[model samples]
Target: MGWSLFRRSRIAPGLPVPGRCGPRRHALATERLLLFTPRTRLDVAAAIAASADAQAQGWLGTKADEVLPDPAVRRALLAWRPAGEDGRRIPRELAEPFTPGPDDPLLLVCVRRSDLGYAGALELQHLAGEMGGWLAPGCRGQGLGAELFRAGLELAHTHLGLATVRAGAETGNTASRRALARAGLVPDQGPRRHTLPDGRVVDAVWHRHDTATPAHCGDHQESPRRRPVTRSGSGHRTS
Candidate 1:
């Protein structure tokens, strides 16, 4: 899994909607994927469904007793839309867009350009300058993991305006570690042990990508400072 650690916070209702004030919703594109801030119930539902896959849940660590919506129902919800409605128009339920506070994590849904299908999700924690993401079962092991995480770096550095972005993975998850490295993140210092949301403990390794220029000894340029890594209950999976 390409999961990272961060404190979780609730997104309060009545926050200024996207495009009205604060940070506007973002959309990013890669050669094979389109990443966008979720704007509709369908978008949210699809992301949840992708994360609920049995293989993904293992690394993502879900509540043991929590029963998610039926897989069939989730797929049906993704296929539903208002009759004769423009596919591009925002629906009534999403009139008040989800807006995260400066410190809150923002989730961007990833879709395959070839079919516009739900491929996975990416999470960006603005305050911590870190990101984590996962791919759907159908999309994993297809070399999409590197692209998914590269998009995360773009979100943190280009869109979110962060100079440094970080990610962590269980030491034994070689696939995820390779994907992070391929996405330009290098090894960094962090806690050797991490607890997954499911309460399992494992050896952990951290990686980071920094866009800031290094400060010279005599120059007055101030290098970017690193933020302390913290554990959270949310987990992320990747190809």
Candidate 2:
């Protein structure tokens, strides 16, 4: 079965209209993992925890570190994390969910279905038509990076109705380069120097994937419904 990119009004302006035929949350899946729409405090905690990961903090270009320590930030962050984690096994008393609107381009919590554990997250920028993601420490070294990029491609084209999605990886980040390539993104001219949140400057290589471009792309439009997504380690995608 194909993955659904529908949310049930728990998110934003780009969310399927009240009577739209599609799903509200974009539920993408590959062979071993599922990129489900994040909807609870648990997911937020996981995302936050993932961000705090050494790999993430080191490579992520953008960060909310300054605000992350604030109490209001936690509440707001928790307020957006759908109340609890992404499992039904949790006790109701421990569940803490929240709502979404401006938090468009839903972040799909990368989960390993076999164990129902957080692997990473994939983000969609509705208006900008961009995508980014990261994989957890435990899930690295398994070709999951490509899976994440593929999933992001799906959210960009099939689900978000975007004509193209742009991504950039720091120079020397072989894993990310390989992942983008496996997902069909091709080298494109773009900013060579990128600055990270921690004030580190790294040379960045750019890539682009589009619904209408081919020679520029090694792979073409394939449905994310059945496409396998992959990735791992600290990674970032700049538009």
Candidate 3:
């Protein structure tokens, strides 16, 4: 519910304590945003509320529907209060600590650095090497999408130790495509027709950013022109 709840624990000065998610890996900060694992049910609720916006839902609602299929269930979720406030407690299963596997997709709650307000969420699917995210209505149209996605690229390459990251956008979604390009993803090949979680079929375009060298044919030696990019930093944090 607060930054303190997600604060890092250190074994000693300059020494981060390692947990199941890894040391100092639960939070990432950018020039304008902070991405971190959800620490409470409220964090997830905030994200749900953000994504429920009509405009955002058109592109992102399917996941929310799957997460809370029943309208009654969703209402209850949004209406639920923190423990001790209203004679109710969050369910144990929902409150249990999160321990994700190495290949699990990373989901980070996004907050604005300027106001510490809930912005939205970012996700990176490791096996697919893809990323996607949405923003709250209040945070949209201010050019933060690119920053949000750049943070995704940072998470993939710098924090998660990924060689490449890819993203897809509906061909007509100029805003999203522009943001992906601004985030340093170059247009790449992918299926022209793609199905959304909501079952809509749409024209899609893929983009990717690669730090790895392209594979060569058999018996071919590496060429200087194809050298992998050298990258190093800890600007992005993760869990």
Candidate 4:
């Protein structure tokens, strides 16, 4: 969703928590990408670039209107730590770890395995198990979108111990809706009004995924559902 406004300045970069879903060391491996739990300076740089890049901002609205009013504050928030903690665990005060407790959110960066480049981002929100993400321009339309969503599914269901997850998308963002469906999050009932980071209200469609059912991979029979009108509410930009 709105990856641009998610700043973690108060705490050090987070890694997977020790107990929730076994010992996962800051990384989730997909066939094409590696989703890192975000603990290094390099990761911080890639995440900021992917979120702040001109192309992604077009869809994710990376230019979040609130917070980050100062360039230095924004930079500090995105800046990674000095090198030398790749495999080691360094302690810091944390607001959210990968496997969050109630009221915590998890943020992970998607990286292309071949080139080790940032491809996109995914977020699991505070205690509720809702998810949202985006892919870079170069990574779009290459069937990587489904992979990104699948990585999110693995994190939320297998890693974070959530039984189901919900995601929402703007009406016109068909690519995002496609990815969500491919990841097994099918159409579920919900309202249509969604608020953008810029504060504009737009019609959106909602989808849900349950861990009990497996996603039908390579199935192109389904597309996002078009729903009726409803009351407006604040939500993430999934597409």
How many clashing residue pairs are found in candidate 2? 27
Evaluated against the true structure, the overall lDDT of model 4 is 0.56
Query: Residue-wise lDDT of candidate 4 within 14-83, one digit each (tens)?
Result: 4322122222233465667667656554554445555564445555554465323445543543332322
Residue 180, candidate 2: C-alpha displacement in angstroms = 0.9
Q: Write the per-residue lDDT of candidate 3 for residues 84-120, one digit (tens) a residue.
A: 1245566876555554444445677777655456777
The residue-by-residue lDDT of candidate 1 on 156-205, one tens digit each, is 66555567777878777777788898888899887788877678887888
- Model 4 stretches with alpha carbons more than 4 Å out: 1-26, 63-104, 213-235
lDDT of each: 0.62, 0.57, 0.59, 0.56
RMSD of each: 9.4, 9.4, 9.9, 10.4
Ten consecutive residues with minimal summed lDDT in candidate 3?
Answer: 230-239
Arrange candidates, best TM-score first: 1, 2, 3, 4
- Residue 214 error, candidate 4, Å: 12
Off by over 4 Å in 3: 1-25, 61-64, 67-103, 213-239
TM-score of each: 0.72, 0.68, 0.67, 0.64
Ranking of all candidate structures by their lDDT, best first: 1, 3, 2, 4
lDDT tens digits, residue span 14-113, model 2: 2222122224455666666666665565675666554454455566745565324444543433233233333235445324563445434556776665
Query: On a 0 to 100 scale, what is the lDDT of residue 87 in model 4?
Result: 44
Best by TM-score: 1
